[model samples]
Structure formats: structure tokens, C-alpha cells
Target: MPRKDTCKRRRIVLYAVRSAEFTTSDDRQTVYIVETDHDTYLFILFTSEVERNLYLYAREEEVSDEVKENFTNLANELSFDPEAITYLPKVPVPRRLPCLAPCDCPGDAPRVPSPPRRARPPDGLPRRPYGARSAQRQGLLFRQLFEAESFTYTYLLADPKTKEAVLIDPVLETAQRDTTLVKQLGLNLLYAVNTHCHTDHITGTGLLKQLLPGCRSVISRDSGASADILIREGHALKFGAFALEARSTPGHTDGCRTYVLNDQSMAFTGDALLIRGCGRTDFQQGSPEALYRSVREKIFTLPGDCLIYLAHDYTGQTISTMEEERTLNPRLTLPLEAFVELMNNSNLPKPKQIDFAVPANLKCGVQDVAV
Candidate 1:
């Protein structure tokens, strides 16, 4: 299993409080709090005329060392004196004031016995799986596969009547599993397509071709990656009676494309537009401005109800819709200037596998040696 920190995506929201009152006292102090979707924290600073000391306290769950380090760095950038910034040990949970009740016997009455906890599943029992399709339209065969190591999602789409299929953003590590599923479903795998030249994981196109002799590799002509078929903007990748219209939605990378189903039912947005977020634009030929324009003009132009599939999601989200993203995506929903600032200010670390993934992906997942 991956480390807890690595498995979860990092989302830190920092708030600087000019003055905050502590529960124990009415004294106002300069405090900075770091919050995430799950937890809240307080950064307490002790300042004198000439020196300052900083301490961190969690208001809810325990904060990870990685989070502390990140917030500490952020604090320094915000001009906070960090000469003695330290993460204090977990503090005791503060007790609430006793409830006053005249009817209830003796103010404490054993605190009204807590409810019994539900029994958990047996150890041998398998946990619920991920990637199950939440909904499917008539005559469409769709499956979503997740690769945990890279947090990448690969999609398989086929026509129920003809069994002709196309796969999108398949990862090298999950190639065999994907092909096996295709075979088991008795589908005719026609094309292995990539939305862009990914920097985090190698594409499974080459491997799929080697396994399914008739399968062809597809990618954008401008992606600069070798493939059996190099498609340009407006090209239709058809299988059976259905087709996907390749719309040039470059920004996260120069070659990024959003493939919309011919009927406008759905779109597979690569790293260009994610669920409530977007791909980082610090590397791999990324451009914040270009991404903003691409999303606004190309993707946002799709039908409001059109389902939007993503290439990767680290926050356990499976899918979203065009309308949802247009209105709720924190990054894309912002004004152009604010969006650019958000992207530019994102201090994200480079993908750990970028060095090996990029070269192998450039060759469509044909590696020199086996793992």
C-alpha cells in the first residue's frame, strides 16, 4: 500500500488572521490557520518586541508532518517570522461547558449512553471497488478503470450492438488488465487513444497493439508522439456507428485534446479540465493563459448536461458534467486573471515517475526492459 500522504492529494487552504481569540482566554493573538476539506488547524505565534516563536495546533484531526512542513514554508513566504516555528504535540481535546438542564437528573446523568458502533465487514471480505460506472446511456458500453499508482483513469467505450471499441488514456501498468477485460467482454478493440503526451505515466497503446494485433494507436498529430494514426483537430475517431470528435483543447500541454462523443453526450477531458480543479501548469510545456482560453471556448461550449470524463483524479471523484465544472470548478470558474494567478501560484511537486514515464510514453509505452 502507498503511504497515507502519497495516496491522498494535498489541498491546503491557508487563512491569516490578524487577531483571533483563544477559547481559554479573551486575549487576541495573530494566528494563521490551515484548512483542508477534512480538517482545520491553528498556527499560534508568540511574539515579543525582538523575537517570535510559532506553534501549530490542530482543531480537528491530526495534521500530518508533510502538511506541517508545507504550511511552515507557506508561512515563511507570507513574511511570518519562522525562527522558532515548531509543530507542537497533539493537544488534549478541550471539554465543552456542561449543559444546564432542570428536568434531566443531576446535570451529568452518565452523559446519555452513546450509541453502539456498527460492526465492520470481516477481514477476508473484499472492500467495495472503485471505477464502477455510475450511469450509462442506452446502447453504450462503458467502463472506467483506475490505476492507483499514478492516480490515472483509463476509459473503455464500445457500441453494444457492434462490439467495436475505443480506449482512452490507458496506463502502461494496467495494459494487460484492460486488454483482458476487452477480450472477456468479446469486444473488438479498434483503437487505443491518448489525449496528450502525458508526463506522469506511459500510455498502454503499444502494449495493447502487441496483445491485440488489430488495435491501432491514436494520438493528436501535434502531440509529437509516435502513433499508428496521428489525428488533427475535427477528426472523428469512429468505431461501429458511434464516433468521438477530437476538439483541440491544448493548455495543460500543447497537444491536449478533448474528445466529445458525436452525439454530444459526453467528453473525455484530459488534463485540461478536471473535476473542480485542473492540471498543474508549471511544467511539461504548460500555459495557464492558454488553458484558460481552451477551457472557456472549447469545453465550456459543450452542452450543459454533457458528461465530462477525466484522465486522472486523486480525490476519489469519478466524473462530473460540463455545467457542474463551469459553475463549480474552483480554478476554471474564476475570472481569467484569478484563474491564471491560481495556476501560477500552485507550488506543486513534479510527478515522481516523470523521468521514466515521459520517454516511455513518447514511444507509446514501449520500454527497453520489463519491470
Candidate 2:
């Protein structure tokens, strides 16, 4: 399958075929059907006076053997390269509701109930509802903020009803932008939290506390960083009716923590895990073995549907799910021995801002006074 970003741009378009008709059953034209484990594709080679166009049709699941044979024969006849045919990218199609007929029965007549509609976020964003699980309930407001220099992601989660909010992994450079959004949303900033002491950028917790007087700075007790509140494993940060349980998940750093929502709906996984990859465990008290265990025991143990929000995503990925990371993340999905070897041999360059950022972050983003 193509990458998500690539698939997002996949669209089927039919070129100018002034007058065209389905010639599959007639066997008078070149038509082929290819089958794969997850999907079936139908390819039609249309010959025109000026050019030849390939029209492809994609369907979910298996296709008949006869259709496969037909496609193979057509390909052989045209001397087409087998490698030239490719599966069309998967696209999300809207679910079609069953047809409903007007009821003309007595009041006591039995009626068929309609299927439950999926709930959506207030901003009309799509929600994932698989199998028996229902969509995410309303009242949760989520926004993703970015710091370009560090490629860090700062998340703002709020309980709209209570106007209580929290900012996660905020960078100092983006403090004003984050505060502006908080004020614009009329939200009461309750906490400016860090998943860990970051080496790539200074924490915005101090600046945010200065700007939002009611907000407190928070970090893990083991982080060796000054904060208004130092949390440990099993500690719950509560605001309004929501609570985030802090789960010790040190690997990239000794104090790395994964904050999980009370509902187990999502988790903030700092640098412990990333989209398709993970953080380098070569410095900053980094340990590949410990990180591997942390991911498997702390993060991977969550429900498959639980969203995994990362502190930094170099590939522009905003969020992923436990299920996706479990099956798709190359680093986390590897065997323990393989993962350790990979991490040790990564040989990545050190962060450019580590020298300055680490010291400032140790003091909660405060610079030392001149002697």
C-alpha cells in the first residue's frame, strides 16, 4: 500500500472517451482484472486514434479466478510489462445508508430501528470508529501546535464545558502563539506540561506560567528539572472532569513519561515513540533496552484505538494510533535484540541546540543571571 500522504492525493479520473461502453463480457477489447490480498483492480486498455489510455477500477477484497485469467491473457497479448501494472491507492468512501421505506402501519406495528450515527468533534473533524467501538464522545477539544525550528508538536487539550485546558510539550519560542490561542478560545489554562526535559528546544512552561498566572508548570519528578509540580508514576493530573494518568516510560530519557487520558482514548508519548520510528537512544541517558520495554509495557498495552500523540514528528505526521504503531512502527515492532542493535548503530548527529537548551530546560526554561 502507498503511504498515507501519497494515498490522500489518489483520485480516479476518466479522460475524454467521447463514447465508451463496458466491453468486458463482449471480450472484444483489452480488459484485465488483477487480484491481491486486500483488493481487486480492473484495468482497461483503451486504444484511440491518437493515444492509448489505461482505465483502472478498484474494489475491496477478492476477485474471481476467471477475471484474473482474462487480465493475464490481455497483458500477454499486448506484451505489457507485468511490473507496469500497479494497484490503485486506497481511498476512503462514504458509507451508504440502507434505503428506508415510509411506514404505513398501525401504531402497534413493529418498527425497524435505524443504525446509530457516529459522533463527530465539534469542529466537524473525522473520528475513527471501528467495529463495536463508537466514535469519540463530544466535549473534547484538540488542537496541534508546531514549533518549526525544533519540529516539535505542542498539543492543547481542553474540556469545552468546563473551559479547562492543558498544553503539552510546549516550546519556549511558541509560548506567545500558544497563549494567544488559549486566550482566543476563552480557555482557562490549568497546566503547561512537559513529557520530558527536551534537548532540542527550551520548555515554554516558565513563559506560559508568567503569561497565564493560573497555570502551573509540570514535569516528571525524575526529570531533574524545576517545575511547579513534579509528577511520578500513577499520578493523575486533573482539570475539570478530565484526568491524565502519568505512566513512567523512560527510554530516550530517564524521566520520559507517557500521559494517558482517563478514558484511555489517547496518549502523549514524548520522544519515546514516533510515527514509523522512535527517538535515538544514544544520548541523554538513553537506553534502547529500557525504551523498548517502556513502549511494549506502557504504551503498546493501551487499547488499539487509543491515539498516540508525539512530541516531534519530522515527517509532518500529527497523530497515530496504538494499533498503527504496533504494526507499522519499524523501531518498536522489531525484536528486542534487533531494536537494540539498530539503536546503538544509528550514529545520528547530536542536536544542534542541546548545549543551550538542556541547561535552560534544567532550570525550567530560565536563563542564569549574569554574575
Candidate 3:
């Protein structure tokens, strides 16, 4: 099994009104405490200095000034920037306080539980007839594949009637697994499509071409990458009767393209957009300014109900919707300058595979295939 972060020394505490439950004291103002791996501390969620003062104004006799001082110092040590904090709606549970929000707490902290999920299409919705005359009657055969090493998501979309299929952002290590599944499903794999030239993991397009003859590779022409087919803005990549409308969204990389299904039911946003985050613009011709525009204009313009599929998700999320992302994406929701500052200052660790992945991915990840 792939190793995942189980627990990272994080906890939550809520200060409630004297009348509310979960209060630690009986004095009109009460204190809440949380325990972590290292020590016990008073925890409160605050966005600005003003809010911090509100949290600090506990009943002085009940909670000592010394304890409040320590809390203030800890919050400062964590560099509580207003831009970094994301506030969530307070959920109303029976006895426990609903999760409030998450912050950039010290250490590999666990995230606070999110509010109850919104309604979505049912998982077992019966597939429509393959060749039905009505556009609404056609069903898409979709599969989401994962490569644990790089935390990448590979999507396989196909037409149920013709079995014509496309694989998006496939990784080199899992080429055989994808090939086996395609064969098992009797799919005629038509295209191995890449949304952009990746840095973290080598592309599986080349291997797929070799494994499944006649399968061509696809990428954005601006990506400066070699491929069997180069697509551009407004291009349509058709397989069977359905097509993917290519929209240039180049903030993550010069070549990033978001592929929307013809009917606008779904969009494959490469590294450009993520579950509650977005692609890093620290390298690979990354421009926070350009990415902000791309998302706000090209992606946000889609229908609110359009389903969003992404290239990678670290948090085990498989899908999201336009309405959810437009409203909830922490990074993108920021104003342009704030978004730029946040992206530029994210001191993320370098990807482990960049050195080899970039060179091979430029050639459609073909160089890594065993001859």
C-alpha cells in the first residue's frame, strides 16, 4: 500500500459563548484547549489582529494573562498572514462544534474536517444507451487512475459505442496498467493526450503509443513539446461522436490546456486547477499573473454545474464542480495581486523527478519506453 500521511500533530479548539456547550469554564467568557504531540495549548481561529484580540479577551481571572501571551506568541511564530487563512462555514452539529476553518499551523498539521459535502450526481447512475439519437442519451465511459509516487491523476475518457478513447496526463510508471485495462475493456485507444509538459513525472504517452499501436500523442503546440498531434485554442479533438474543446489556460506552464467536453458537462483542468488549490507557478515558465487571468476568464466562464476533473489531487478527492471551485478554491478566490503574492511566496520543495521527467516528457515521454 502507498504510504500516506496518517496524522501530523494537529488539533482544533473552539471558544464558545458562556451559554453554548463545549465551554471549558463557567465564567461568562470561557477558554478552549487542544492537545497535540508536543504540548497542550489554547487554540483559536482568527484572521486579523482585531479577531486575535477578540480571542485573547477571555475572562482574565479564569484564563491567566500569561496563557494569552503564550497564545499570541505562538500565533506570531506561525506567521498568521490574513491572506493565508481560509474560513469555512460553521457547521451545526448536535453536541460538537462544526469545523470552522484551517490555517498554516506549524508542522505537517492535519486539516480540519470540511463541512458536509454538496449534492452531486449519483455514482451508480445508469449508463445511457451508446447509440441513442438524443445527445442526452449518450454516456461517457470515464476512469480515473492514480500513480502514488508523484500523486498524479490520469484520466481515461472514451465513447461507449465506438470504444474510441483518450488517456489524459498518463504517467510513465503506470503505462502497463493502463494498457492492460484498455485491452480488458476492448477499447480502441485513439489518443494519449497531455495537457502540458509535466515536470514531476514522465509522461506515459510514448509508452502507450508503443504498447498500443496506432495510438497518437497529443499536446498543446505552445508547450514546446513534440507530439503526434499539436492542438491549439478552440481545437476540437474528436473520438467517436464526442469531442473535447481545447481552451488555452497557460498559468501552470506555457503549454497548459483545459479540455472541456463538447456538451460542457465536464472539464479536464490539467495542473492549472486543483481541488481547493491550483498549480504552482514557481517554475517552468510559470506566471501567476497569467494563470489568474486564465482561470478567471477561460475556466470560470464554464457553466456552474460543469463537473471539474483535474490532473492531480493530493487530498484523495476525485472530482469537484464549477460552483464549488469558483466559490471555495482558496488560492483562486484571492484578488489578482494577492493571488500572485501567494503563488510567488509558496516555498514548496522541488519535485523528485524533475531532472529526468522534463527531458523525457518533452518528447511525449517517448524516450523512456523500452525499445
**What local lDDT score does residue 262 receive in model 3, on the 0 to 100 scale?**
78
Query: What are the runs in model 1 whose C-alpha is more than 4 Å off?
Result: 1-136, 365-371
User: Which pairs clash inside model 3?
Assistant: none
lDDT of 2 by residue, 1-371 (tens): 21211111211121222111122111112333344565545455543211233444543234466665655565654534333444343333212211122223111122222222333445554345321122124347778788999999998888878989989999888899998999999999999899999999988888888888788888888989888889899898887767789999998999999999776667899999898888888888999999999999999977566778899988777878887898889888899999999999999998999998898888873433221
Which tens-of-lDDT digit does each residue in 211-249 have in candidate 3? 999899999999999998999999988988678989999
Clashes of each: 0, 1, 0
Cα shift from native, residue 59, model 2 (Å)? 45
| Model 1 Cα lDDT, one tens digit per residue, 4-115 | 1110111111122212221111111334445556655555554321123466654223666677677769666534544445655544321221111112322211121111
What's the TM for model 2? Answer: 0.64
In the order shown, the candidates' Cα RMSDs to the true structure are 21.0, 19.7, 19.8
Question: For every model shown, what is its TM-score relative to the native structure?
Answer: 0.63, 0.64, 0.64
Query: Candidate 3, residue 30: CA error in Å?
Result: 53
Candidate 3 matches the true fold with a TM-score of 0.64
